[model samples]
Target chain A: MDEGSAALVAAGLGKRYRRGWALRGCAVAVPRGRIAALVGPNGAGKSTLMALATGLLRPTEGTVAVRGKPGFLAQGKPLYQGFTVEEVLHAGRALNPDWDDAYARRLVAEAEVPLGARIRTLSGGQRTRVALAVALGRRPEVLLLDEPLADLDPLARQEVMGALLAEVAEQGTTVLLSSHVIADLDGICDHLLLLSGGRVQLAGDVEELLAEHRLLIGPRELDVPAAAVVERRETGRQSTVLVRGLEPPDDAQAHEPTLEELALGYLRAGRTSGREVAA
Target chain B: MTWVAWRQQRLLTLVSLALVALVGAGMAALWADLSSVLPADPAVLDERYGDLLGYVPFVMLAMPVLLGMFAGAPVFAREFEQGTHVFGLTQSIGRTRWWATKLLVAGLPVTVAMALLGLLNAKALGPLSSILTSRLQTPMFESQGYVLGAYTAVAFALGATAGLVVRSTLGAMAITLAGYVGVLAAVANLGRPHYAGTEYSASGAVEPGAWRVEIGYLDAQGATTTFAGQKCGETPIAQCLLDQGVAGRFARYHPVSQFWEFQGAESGIVVLVVGVLVAVSAWAVRRVH
Candidate 1:
């Protein structure tokens, strides 16, 4: 509720369903004007964390605060079937006291969401776009999107992501978007929070994550620093080692991993070790 | 609107209003007796129209329940089920604000509409009751009166509250309707008019021969004739009397001829209880998740 604080802050956040912890002891802080990606595998609690952060779900323990107004782009687009896009948008305008009509119109125009089209009649992707457009129109302080780019055609994804980045740039709006597609987060998000098994294994700047983690490929018997190996893949002649927080040994030939390779290594480690990885 | 509210449920609002109007018209037609065979005769039709007017109050009851089940239940539950509730929660509006907006948007309009319809329908149905039967003209049970208005408001609030608590359209509807019927039935059976004390006392208690008695008969023309009597408790049949200084033999009866008294008391009680239910629903929505 503190308006002057960071855009988002979570302390020891946890969500325990009847079955088990969907997300536990997760914490994240995102400042204003930055895009943060919640990157995780299926059932990794990315969506759960997003839900908790947005205040859709109460944390079993911990706190999530959005410094100011936030906009949520829900996983699935839901609009009144009988209402046209314009009507639905108008309803938002009526209901939301902070609604920015100009931004809404601009997003609507950019997304090409037909104003007269009934929401139900629009295609799935189009409906998703419309939902996003409405959220953007709100001129929110923080926009939390859950799988907004899922099932989008390449071009559609570009358009939506473009709009999202534009909002972040123009309004200095902080954004937290979840996606399984690493490529989608490549250039758009400056930060990444990788969750596995109901916890955050790693969260930091994309550049820092890339610089600290290394993927070393060499002979199976090649001398390698055991401590640097966060994860390792082995075959008869080739070995791939994912080194965590690597300081790059003085005459070492170890190559730092790309975000994708590092992510894959973390995923492989989670699969093989059966570890909770939250640490 | 705080939290992330949707304007999509306006469909339910429009649909509920239209359906209520149709049902009201149908009830008016069914209960509007235009013939002598109906009751008390068309010459005494004023009261018959009054009987027909009884249905007007039900509009308030039906509309609120309908809104509760259809509007409140789906407001937030559907988003969770569809995996899209996060869209609203992450917005500039906080979760509580979103919930407040949704309730205001969906509940107030429907309640206002019901109130207006109740007034208009009562006016239209007034004449119909008089033309149907003369006996139905009791002042206590007048259609669309303050008593009935209170009942309608409470009923609607209760229904909406149920929707918020239950969080599923079908679930809220089933529970609300069942609760409505059960509460009314229970209150009626528990609070019916009945004798609470003995009808007679002894000589010392009676203070020597002090007695007061009266007899009344309702004529076929619906007028009452009264006779004072010194013969108190003289006959167990056709008359009743009691001594002044002691507990006397007296008859007990309900003030209104039919069960109108019971209905009024029970309706008020039900409304009060339902009002509480609505308040709880609002609170539940405020903390929705």
Candidate 2:
């Protein structure tokens, strides 16, 4: 495997269904060993891209390349309902030729999931842990996790992310996980890809992306360059505009936008564009 | 991949085989006890076995559909319903290997068991040939030979294909049952008779176990008699036949001795259907979301 190569690269990726395209012209690359977040609203092609990258679904018009074998924790963390946790791990071992049994066992042990318990018997948190263990068992160079924290409570979500981060840190594996909520991933993900309307709306180093955008507070009737504003909101007293890669105008007070504000701005921008296309 | 697929279907496959084994045990006992009542004619058969004659073949006929619905319908359908196919297909294995291994692992045991079961049923019912009508005939033919196994394979394939297409276990099972019955009806009525050339007999003494395809009188000129001519519906039909100058009753039939030939032919047709189903399923698996 090429250690310096991007963990995953998609070029002009497009996926079509019976009625319409789910994803189109998608292109992004996450550098090796980065914790990348795929942020989007529901039905923004986040899951579609994840599915394509993991090879579960093929692209209708492009290609996805993974530097090495990828391990996927699919949406809902689907373990065979009838299988015990041990059997699920056994299935992981059987399916993956390069399975790391020790790592798989340690993950389950650390999470306190009982080996003999059926998958359906486990609660949401426990099931997520077991599913993650199965994916990690393959010792893949890149791990694609789709909605790993969707069903967990806030505390459980923190714990699951903590566990996931701890493992990825130790192994130095690249990971790309998808989520609709920005607050959950605001701190953990250093690389970000925001998707909407089957395209990449924003993608880059999270810190860099944040630093490039500023929230400008100006008068409600203030005039500004349309090209400079990523998104805007107006009130009777004031207008708040998200400006990208620019200084505030002469009369406005500029403030650094929080990661959530930045992400929300981009997500809304993408959705508006998507609706325009649909209309 | 094979192990994973086998594990998924293990319990159902074993249970289905156990059901076949149970049937085999009873049939074996029947075969063992069959010699005591042999060499008798049909008149004494009713006094001997009575309604038991009807019960055995009915069970035999139902086995393939039962096994097909139980074993085949849920293979892919349940995976999709539970969302486990996402896990299965995303593994390092190619979709084709996953689909093919599943088909083979899930299908092999029941097919071999049904074939063996059919052999047992045939052997068990052989001595009662006078009472069984003919192994080469309808309903009886389906129960007694290798075609039974082939029917099972076709039914199983139908079920498995339906699962992939419908993506629902209950839907697949319903399709399997309906498709199995439909295929059997179509083959018995339309496909079986064309397997080989039928033998023509000059007398009404067509051999027992031979399937009677058609029968008509042949006149002195050796032309087949038509219904529009001198009616045989008259009283004293023997005298009426003489008055009409009918020389013989010509019969077209599949002989009892052609049992293996018919088995090979019918089984081949159904197995071809099985092949098509498998190929379609293999293609459909890749297309599933």
Best-performing candidate as measured by DockQ: 2
Model 1, residue B1: C-alpha shift (Å): 5.7
Prediction 2 TM-score vs. true: 0.95
Show the lowest summed lDDT stretch of 10 residues, model 2 chain B.
Answer: B226-235
Question: Which predicted model would earn the best TM-score?
Answer: 2
Give per-residue CA lDDT, model 2, range A64-124, as digits (tens). 8888879999999998988888889889888888889999999999999989999999989
Give the residue spans of candidate 2 off by over 4 A. A1-4, B228-236, B242-247
Error of 1 at B112 (Å): 6.2
What would the per-residue lDDT of candidate 1 be over residues A1-279, giving only the tens digit for each residue? 233556888889888888778888877887677798888888888888877876678889999888877788766655555668887677667657778887787777777777999977987778877887788777788888888888788887887788778767888888998988888778778877888887777777888888887667677765567876788777888776788776654434588677777776776676533344333
lDDT of 2 by residue, B68-137 (tens): 8999998899899999999998887778888888899999899999998888888877556556567666
Error of 2 at B103 (Å): 1.3
Give TM-scores of chain A for all candidates.
0.91, 0.95
**Chain B TM-scores across candidates:** 0.54, 0.91
